[model samples]
Target: MIHPQIPLILTALLFSAFFSGMEMAFMAASKLQLELQEKQNSLTGRIITHFSTRKARLTATLLIGNVFALVLFGIGMARSLYPILTAYLPASWQYPAVFIIIQTLVTAILALTVAEFIPRSLFMIRANTMLNVLAVPLLISYYILYPVVFLVVGAIRLVVVKLLKMEFSEEKPVFGLTDVDQFMKKSLYQHETEKVPEVDARIFHNALEFRTVKVRECMVPRTEIEAIEISEPINALRQAFVQTGHSKILVYQETIDNVVGYCHQLAMFQKPTDISSILTPIIAVPETMLASELFVKFVAEHRSIALVVDEFGGTSGLVTTEDLLEEIIGEINDEFDEESLLEQELQPGIYLFSARQEIDYLNDKYNLALPVGDYETLGGLILEMHGDIPNEGTIIQAPPFTITVLSMDENRINTVQLVRQAELTAED
Candidate 1:
């Protein structure tokens, strides 16, 4: 009752899978090409955006070869399997099984392994290099594949999308924002690309910081900032820089908030006898500047920092590229920075300690004062308590953090961390 076109029909179906899978693998190279040539346009840029461009020669080979392969299988199925299967397999059974099993299996295997898997693996292997080489061909793939796939899917989409009001793109591939975020933040992403821990940390931190960070979150308190008075003597100004070791010193009119200008370290020694020498213009930015905008200014100026000021023209605090970077890296320390943090994790959140760091910095970070006094340093507070260093295990109210001493080094308190009992880390 039926012509035996079984083999041909089966082959056609198998071929479709190969083409689809090829499209996916081709998609990978396309992505890489686009990323590389995002700035470099022309045929090169077009190619970079092209689906066939990433792994060009191979993709073109696949595109040409696989298309014919798809036709062979499709013809085989329509002419051969359609008749025989319609006759042999009961109509009820054919509809249930979809009457396309053999072809499905073949194409699925070829597409998964040969077209999709193999090509994607290769593209990733040479991702960076191919980005330059394959830009053009990928674009060709885009144009070639889109219409063909859309034609195949258009009638089906018309029924589902218009009559049924279902929404889906048969020709266009889709992904989510989370996918992009994961790729950017993934450890494997920049493994060989950027190996430095600090650099990696900075990248990760920046990704996280961009979401909702406000200026107030990073601004230094009005009190701790060391400023230069406009009329302050040169010796005092020089002394201030030496003691605080800050690069951009805020030069204020009268009060710390009433800032007028900034002194760059590079120009510090070059300050002439002229009164204007000490009065360099400040790199002032608003508290509302988006982090991304600030990042751009940083790149254009080739500088790593800026000053956050109020609308009234007063200095609020400083923001270094490093500080912004720290939003990702946790913290960046140089050879000069001492690791005065607690030596051990005494408990889940608590840390043991010696008291020697500035009380103001600690108060700023840990809020260790019950009523925060004028006292500026931790060592100063400990000394003032009994006019001497308290012995091991001295209990006192340091305001926010509970003090539990483990050891002391003569007059210097040493070996301590905090209990971080409350939401300390979040508040700071």
Candidate 2:
């Protein structure tokens, strides 16, 4: 026959586990997910939303419930064990102090492992689901224990605010960047499992990371800029526009490094005789400037394009508002963008890429673990490795990768072929 103490001990342990698991589930569950559920107006959703707002009260209730359950467990355990221990132990060890020590040790071990660790871990794994499943029961317990919780929490707040001169505010943002980022990551993972498109998730991920991107990461390089000397005639500028098929052409002083401004194709209809007569001023920014900051500057200044400069104040590249936006939204291909900028996979481990492609972009798209340093583009990587401008047909060995220049002019690399030697050999 079961002892009367046995039923009390078992029930106490179950309540302890429930309270402990609910506490962890509340802390670990996503606030954004909770807010979304709250919009559904379900019973569980309403309870969770209410608890989310009064977090201190909820936390106090869980802790108080846990304490009561643990107290009951200790009482039941002591009563049940007393007779058994006294029956087995020698008389010298039957003292109250010794019995208390043994009882405390056994109770602590059982409570920590059975009531704390296991339940907390399992609940935290599917925190949102666990919260939704147990919301009603938690709410009932919350109200049942509210008076005690209110007194405990109110006393603590009073000490903290009144006696200690500490400020206290219970307000919390409904959601934060971290919440959105985690939500996006979870959605992406779900999309992968469901084999659904993840374009929206990818864009959200990019926007979150946009703050860290620098101007040099997105700008068209200096080598690719098309410009005419400021002293050049209007006809020469008009011819440049026709040849490059670009609506706007930059105007430089004596060299491209001394870029003055840009001239628009529509300015030609006004019959401007000189390049200076139609030059529209462009902003210049440092290469190290954050893309997000630059975007704010662009909007505030009512400008769309800016020239990026290095530390020495020389022109580094050109960045348009479209380019800045593309950092978050992906590529925006206008008519001016080169249609033939090569990017293709010829085979499993072989690829053809435009030399202008950013190293980070290549690494992310193709899983190329290429080393990143002071350089940005594929051509820059080749230059850093080879220590010189490579000619057409030139082969460069950057371990794990064999880069061969497919096409280049005297100044800049245009296209290249890359073979991942290790990947190919492994497959073979």
Candidate 3:
């Protein structure tokens, strides 16, 4: 037969678990998810939104409720266990100190495992779901414990302001990057299961990651820049504009490193005789500058093109507003842009790629899991490993991948064929 105290202990444990699980669920639930739900006018969403807005009060309520439940649990546990221990244990174990030690160990083990760990773990796994399921109950609990929570919070604020002389502000933005990022991750996971579309998820992921992208990662390298000497004749500039098919041609003083300005193809209509007459000043920026920062600068300055320079102030590459925009919305090609970069999978796990293809792009698209370092592109990776420009048809081993130089110019690699070793082994 079960003792009356047994039911009391179980009830206390259940209440304790509820408070602990609700607290974990509230903390782990994505704010963006909650915001979206709230927009839909759902009851659970409204309740969660209300509680989330008063986060301090909600947290205080949970803690206070948990303390009360734990106290009841301790009393019930002591009452139920004292009789069993006294009946079964030796005479020496009946001492108050010894019984207290044993009771603490048993209570701690039961409280931590059943009422804390299990519920918190399960609640955190499906936090939004748990919150939605328990929203009504949590709302009732919030009101029931509001007075206690209010006093506790007021006391804390009083101590902080009067004794510690510190300012306390609970103001937080409704949503942040972390909330949006978590929502995107969930969308991507759903996409994998064919439950949602991936396009928006990928775009959001790119936008969130755009802040960390450096100018050098997206800029057109110096070797690929189409520029002419500033001292050159106006006819020479026109010829360059026609041959390169570039609207804006950079103007250099003595060498490409000393870029003075640029001449727009539209300037040709003015019938300028010298290159300097039509030259428009171009802004120079460090290659290490963040792409997002560059975008802000461009918008503020009302400029489109910027020359990316190395630490020595020598020209490293060139970037435009379009390039920065591509970091988020993805590649945007105008009529003047090249057809496309060479990206072709010849066979299973074997492919041809332009040396200019970014390492991150290939790794993401093909799941190549290629090693990344200071380099940004396939050519850069090859150069880093080989330490010199390899002639065409030169085979370079880069573990799990065997890269063959398919084409090259006097200075830079143009294209390469990559073969995955694991695929070849499986075929064999």
Candidate 4:
């Protein structure tokens, strides 16, 4: 006849296998996996994420469960052997040696077969899918057993800290911005991980940097700011709006320095007599304001764009919500934006660019060490280096690269060619 303890032993071993697999699955899944799963709006993903975030609690739950299973297994094994020991063994021989030997042999066999090897191997093979399947049951079990698990974890911590006068702190690891950037880029570049795409990774990396970027860094400079004089004819204002491709135009009274407010192009439909009739009061922000802070301000104030002002209260430039977002997510080109504005790669490590391309974009995209102070664009950089308007086809040598002026106006660089020295040497 099968021993009464046999069912109990099987139950314990079954639970042991489950707990082992659960532990392995949870451990093997990365944070990136959790994030991607959550993005997909999966309930299992959310549950796993909840547990992952509370690692200490999850760990305690797993340890408590496994320990309890082992204890049950031990009790079952002892009970099953008790009758045999009493009937077959001599009293003295049955003392501890036979029980110990039998229990150790059984434990070792079960540990390898049921508790350690099979479950772990299966869990590791499909960690994410396993976690998704197990999350619901695991979460249910977690709630039911949480009180006991909490007490056990608390007692253990109390003993380690107070009784032993030791510190046992769990330092959760955090991925730095650089680490995240590299991870996302590599994941996309290799296309090995389907969760993070190239566009998403690039945008995420830029978004991380957006928090630290200042308004001045991405603002359209005063020279580039399209404005209309309040005294100008409505047709003149229409031309300015059409030419600049801006829905909102800065309105100044006497001079561009005296920016009074802004007028939306749609307001032209109202056929107001003057600029003031359609003017909306603009938010003026210091150039030093963080893009993140500016974003919050823009949201709270219901403003899409703000006039970036210097310490003297003169308009230095303008920053829009789009500009701030583009700082994090890359440029958002609309129908209004010229398609040719985007920098083009002519060859490996060689590019064709407008002089108007921001130095920040160049540095971020190319990892260049171009100076930012008193200059904002490649054209500005070339001008500062040459101390004059560079003639068309004139070559200026910057270490590791050379800039050739392709076209220029009297004041600003229109287009240029950039060639890396390494590529030039390779071609030669």
Candidate 5:
């Protein structure tokens, strides 16, 4: 018959292995694996997901159980080893320290190899199967020890959190806006490099970035806005409408700053041609308004276009529903819309781009290390470098890449060309 101490030691070893395996399995289980199992109506998946949702509590339960098992194992090892140590050592040297040291070394080796390492190794490779087999026992232990674990956890948290005033949250780490932007860009890169259908990839990529886009980034600048003065005659308004080929036009009283309203071409013909009679109340939104939010607001307000205003209540620009939608679906061209290339490689290394083109796009397409921070557009980047608006023919040297202002519109760079100085010199 086996000695009582031997049985106790063996039980302790099994207990240690069980808890270690459970902890490893729970932590290593992938979300995708859990999801697939849950879809297949697996009980283990449901249980694991439940524990995962309350990770802190599950962790506490595992720690408590593991500690209890190890304590029993330590006690049994000390008891069994005491006699063997006494037989080897002399009377003077046969002290508790000797037995304790030997027991500690042996116990640590046994705990690490037999209890922790082997179990953890097995659990990692066969996590789903191991977790499935051990689910009921783990769940039972979790519930049985929960009250004690909860009290211990609460007492520790009270001292660590309340008195220490440290932040402790149970929620899982979440992805921020920046993370989402990067993830979308990565996905887009994967699609492009992997040769996903161009149309599908473009649609997918545009849809992802649409939410983060701001109205000011895509709005038609005030300089380019076609507005009819309130005093303009009906015949003049009709002529202006025909020439502009715009269905609706902003109706301003004295200046664009005093934009009264907008009038539809259909309304203009139905009523008097005078801008005031056909004028409809227009909604004003800040330039900082997100494109997605603007889209929702447009639907709720039943309006097609809004005048983007500055902090000082002056008209900054105009944004249409089409402008917001185009952020996701690409440019919405119309009969009146001018067909122009936003970016073009003039030659081998030299390229010309519209000022409105985003700096990120230029960096990605040209494989240049353009620094990105507060500035979004190439014009903004140039302006930031100059500390003022750059004029026509302003050759701004940004090291590896040299930017030349090809065209300008008053306060901003309209068109700019970038060329690698080294590459251009080599060619010359």
Candidate 6:
């Protein structure tokens, strides 16, 4: 039931009531600042734009509203207590203690209930309404009492900020990467029981984690690159290009040392007969290009692979649109992309593999930089480590992965099984 002394009760909490209005006014001013910041919207950019404005509004509103609320509340409480204070006790003790108790209790009630809880809730729910309703009257109140309120409070603000050695700013709340992760975790859907899928949650976590990994961790290395030499026979180049099933080829003049440019296969289909026309240049990329930049370059050029180069004019490796895209989204499979049988099942968290499988590709997936230069693939890396090619069931220690030769042929390493050395984290 509404208390019979509704106005009197409100008047008793008048300090709080006015504070609530002032707090809401602060929120309104903050909203205006945020709108200004959001004009060219970006989370970081908007936050930066609003930072000073938010601080200014928060400070000004807090100061002005607080003073006005204090005055109103002091008057209301004193008006309520004047008679009781005089009648109940001797003059000295009655006035002093009563004034202290009333000031403390009423201030506590106003600050906790009206000023804090109500204003915060209203700001969260209907920021605009709070701003318009509360800020307008409070602004008028501030003007009416500026001489008294401004001088004392301004002195306090200046003194506090200076002594603290901090620039004046309003504290703003923010969420961090880990905080977002935890927040998403708590936001459960009643119908959907599954926490973001093991794969998907990890991917989200990885996207957060992606900022931590640089491009070097996921780039193709120089040794296994299958690039076309300017002098390479047209028939051989064409056969290799077709066999590799790559969309773009890096055409280098000598030893991939003199990279001229790139040729797209679609262009190659048109010039089937002209031997000179077949040699197309490729767009080259520097190894230092971040994953973000590589993506931008790929989008603009409409090309997939770029030859990773060094400052001294030597071919480093290659990166494809598919490779760069992997950083943002998890692994994507194209029609040409095939997963080895070893990948489909996690038998003992391991897989059996053909010894002939290119180990460099294995390295690409796991980031295990094994010794892979002597032969073409992982089997070759093993052969180079051993005096001669080992028979099936041969165990090897390639960083980030462990491989056992399931089978091998006399001519080359044929079939083998492999497993990751570490638990597969999505970021990898």
- Top-lDDT candidate index: 3
Candidate 5 residue runs with Cα over 4 Å from true position: 1-45, 55-57, 87-90, 105-215, 235-247, 265-269, 288-304, 321-340, 387-391, 408-412, 425-428
lDDT of each: 0.56, 0.89, 0.89, 0.80, 0.80, 0.58
Deviation (Å) of 248 in candidate 1: 4.0
Worst 10 residues of 5 by lDDT: 191-200
Per-candidate TM vs. native?
0.49, 0.88, 0.86, 0.63, 0.69, 0.53
Least well predicted 10-residue stretch by lDDT in candidate 4? 170-179
Which tens-of-lDDT digit does each residue in 1-428 have in candidate 6? 65343465465355455556445544343332334335646453353334334554445545566655556655655565566567776767765767778767865675577666775676656643455445445455556665766575567678779887766544544334665454334433323664332234445655665665545444565654566776666676677668878666667766667767665667666756533475555677666667777677778977666777777767766777776667667666742244542433345446655554556566666554555663546665677766676876777766666777766556556666666656454325
Best by TM-score: 2
Q: lDDT by residue for model 3 over 136-217, one digit each (tens)? A: 9988987898889889999988998999999865555557898888788778767354544324887898899998999998
Error of 2 at 354 (Å): 2.3
Error (Å) of candidate 5 at residue 367 is 1.5
What is candidate 2's CA lDDT for residue 29? 88
Per-residue lDDT tens digits for candidate 4, residues 284-309, read 89999999999999889788888899
Which stretches of candidate 1 lie above 4 Å from their native place? 1-4, 24-180, 188-221, 264-277, 299-305, 310-314, 325-330, 334-344, 347-349, 352-428
lDDT tens string, model 2, 337-396? Answer: 687668999998999999988898899899999899988889999999999888899999
Q: Candidate 5: which pairs clash?
A: none
- In order, what is each prediction's RMSD in angstroms? 11.1, 2.9, 3.3, 7.5, 6.0, 9.7
Error of 3 at 404 (Å): 3.0
> What TM value does model 2 have?
0.88
Which has the better lDDT: candidate 2, or candidate 3? 3
